[model samples]
Target chain A: MTRRVVITGMGVVAPNGVGLSAFETAVRAGESGVRFIQELADRNFACQLGAVPPLEASHLQVLTTLERKTLEASGIIYGLLAAVEAWSNAGLDVPGNEEDPDWESGCIFGSGIAGAEVMRDATYLIDEGRVKRLGSGAVSQVMASGISAYLGGRFGLGNRVSSNASACATGTESLLLAAEHIRSGAATRMICGACDSGGPYAWGGFDAMRVTNRRSNEAPEAASRPLSATAAGFVPGCGAGALVCEELESAIQRGATIHAEVLGGAINSGGQRKGGSMTAANKEGIVRCIRHAVENAGIHPREIDAISGHLTATLFDPIEIEQWSVALERSGSQFPYVNSLKSMVGHCLSASGAIEIIAAILQIKGEWLHGSLNCENLHPKIAECIDPERVPQTFRKHAVRTLAKSSFGFGDVNTCAILRRYDPE
Target chain B: MAPSRPDIIDRLHRIVEPYVEDEEALTSVDEDTNLLEDLSIDSMNLVDIILDVEEEFGIEIDDEAAEQMTTVGSAVDIIASRLAAAD
Candidate 1:
């Protein structure tokens, strides 16, 4: 029999809030994290409004003063903060250097813009003929696996400590893969998460592409209007989110408080074909991914109590909604309740999936759904696909037993995860 | 070299400030202080310290000389000798 994977703890360094409790409170209250970025405006970015974690360098107390000074990669900072919080929140002690490595533990933390700024700095140094001053940590800072490597060493994890990047789908994919590793007996505990640098350098390309909303620079809080008629484009955002997935048996034996269970999920790509491209998703691929996820979870589509969609405030929001309706074989009034965290936090790129998952788990645990900020005045297409009541515009108390979450990334990659409230049988 | 060993050591003190683990130990550091054992600086960081010293002095310490810089006194001797040769 396969082992079951349950989330014992979670941590979020999200645009809206930095810690679990703060994030939960902010999410439930529907507080917006999107704001006007002066730096972006100075850089002449079309989209000056963005969502970034309201954090200062002083808040990162986990690193030594020297290490923090040497660290130039923001992804590592965000990822480290969230991962450390998740590890401690799981009641796992941070292993001292003298202790043996935790061979049963591992991590799969991910990042999209890990070392962009550091590399830019390196280039400037090289241009100035000061390559010798690049320092020893420069390579580590610029490495793609920097976040996972730093986390692996910090926690002394010996098993499968690796990183993955599949565009924005990275966060949800990491969770699914982490659960699989435990279910396959490769690990007893795994920390899975994703982060984005959220610096101007990281958001510059998206703004250049005009995929981010620029019209709402004055109305920052209303910028990310997911599924709304007045929706522009997604507002670029960045941060980190993490979850500690432990074996169900081990968690029970250790008496760890179980938050939720991972009921398996599916990850797939659209092959960039049939209307799928660098920026758009193929509808058939999304439908297939969800149907497979439900089948993998050993549950029927009708059992999904709610959905957390990859509904960035863009033209694709309605498409994602209709795709979900098609995947679950449910329509109109029969559609399950749905919400998108992007409505408040903007599209956090790679971190969005993990942040959304944490919000979903919170919903299941708290028995309430946060309002989808700015989802009012639903687009005519979205209104036709799902019942207006299914999309909540304000926070409400409700029962969320099995919530399904899906994330479609830049390359038409998609991952749908099924989460259930932990129930001791 | 015109600059004395004490001058080099003073400069070295500033360079090693960020790499060493024990600020207390570094505060009382002498020529005999071992970078690894006394200052608790990781050996890998010694490579970085060497780079910084090169940048500060505008002189490259060969690998052979770099390997011998285990203690503050030894580093001073090598860097001092390099300065003398350059002069």
Candidate 2:
């Protein structure tokens, strides 16, 4: 029999705040963490800046030593810090600090651009006519797998380390892999999630894609408007999110508080760019992933009470969600309360899936779903996507039996995870 | 380090043959065979192939080279250039 998997602990280094308490408070208040970037002078992009976590020098100081130089936009370091907090929360002995060689734990993390900031800075130096400015450790510093490896070594996890680079879907994919590890008896416990810190490369890339909100330069906080009819495009954001997944029996034996049950997850590739566009989100592929996850979870669509949507404030996302809704309708399932976190946090790319799962878990725990922060007008098509009046309202009375979150990324990678609410009653 | 074109092709086939499903379809594939069309390798798998080649050759293919590796011939040429540069 496959052991049931549950999230024991969660840690977030998001724009709203760090740690569980701060995140809970922000989510409950429906706070917007989107902010403007004053450093970039070019007005070519509508949004000058994005909502980024306020980094303390002390935070990076811990990850760096005299012997090892740290990478810029040290997202891996941030992820490690969050992992430590999650470990502490789970009441597990720090891995490397313990002498036990047989500790059964692994790490699977996701990142869109692991050390993009490092590359950006190095490239800038090379562009500035300084041939010697390139650091020799550039590859190691920017490797996407470095974060997972660092976590594994730091926590004394023996050998089992995986890193995913599915752009926005990376976090959710990590969770899926972690759940697989537990089900397949590969690891008894796992740290599964994702993180990313956008540097100039990300900014430039998104800018070139012309998918970023450029008009919200004046209203940085109100820029990311998911489901809103006026939304121009998405805003670039950065953050880290992680969770500790343990076998249900192991968790129960440890007397750990079960947050939610990882029911199932599915991943699929959308064949060749549709409509002659690479960035065009594939509706069929998106629906297949959701359906597969729902089927794997052994739950009908009617059972899902809420959906933490991957609705970045882009033109195509709402349409994708609409297609998803049409599929749900065809499946004879109820349309759950659907909303997007990108409206509040901007799009964290690699950290997106993990963060969305975190939000779903919190909604299950607190029995409240945060509302769209700046959605003055719901997209007419998605206006019926969910109840528009439900915006900015909290739902405590409804028993959330199941929740689903979907994440999509470049290369048409689609991943969806379904979670079952943990009821104390 | 200077692997012949045939050697490079053989090695690439070894790396990608497992991933390629239509064995009969790919059996007649030549140097000009487009990886995307002939082998039907997806972009994500293409990334895996590049990483595999990097580890095997101990040479990094820059983004430009990686992007240009659309066909067997291009991949071989890119590998050759990187190997020569490294030497």
Candidate that scores best on lDDT: 1
Encode model 1's per-residue lDDT on A292-361: one tens digit a residue: 9999999999999999999998999899998998999998999999999998889999888988999999
TM-score of chain B of each: 0.95, 0.92
lDDT of 1 by residue, B6-56 (tens): 889999999999887667897798999999999989888888899889988
- The global C-alpha lDDT for each of the candidates, from Candidate 1 onward, is 0.90, 0.76
Docking class of 2: incorrect
True contacts kept of each: 0.69, 0.00
Q: Judge candidate 1 against the unseen true structure and give its global Cα lDDT, from 0 to 1.
A: 0.90
Q: Considering only N, C-alpha and C atoms within 3 Å, which residue pairs clash in candidate 2?
A: A37-A49, A46-A214, A47-A214, A96-A155
- Give a tens-digit lDDT track for model 2, residues B1-87: 388888889998887774565678668878899988887764546765776788778888777888999998998999888899888
Candidate 1: residue A117 Cα off by (Å): 1.1
Clashes counted in candidate 2 amount to 4
TM-scores of all candidate predictions against the true structure: 0.94, 0.77
lDDT of 2 by residue, A1-425 (tens): 76788899888877777777787788777777777676544545545868676667665544534113334555776687678777778878764443764357988887877677787777888799853435344565588687887778667886378887887889999999999888888788999888887655666778777788878788887788887888888888888888999888889889998889999979887774564135666678887888899898888877777888888888875687676776567322245777788887889888978877888898887777777666777777766565565444443434566888888888788888989876443
Candidate 2 Cα misplacement greater than 4 A, ranges: A42-44, A57-71, A96-103, A124-137, A273-277, A330-334, A384-386, A390-398, A423-425, B1-87
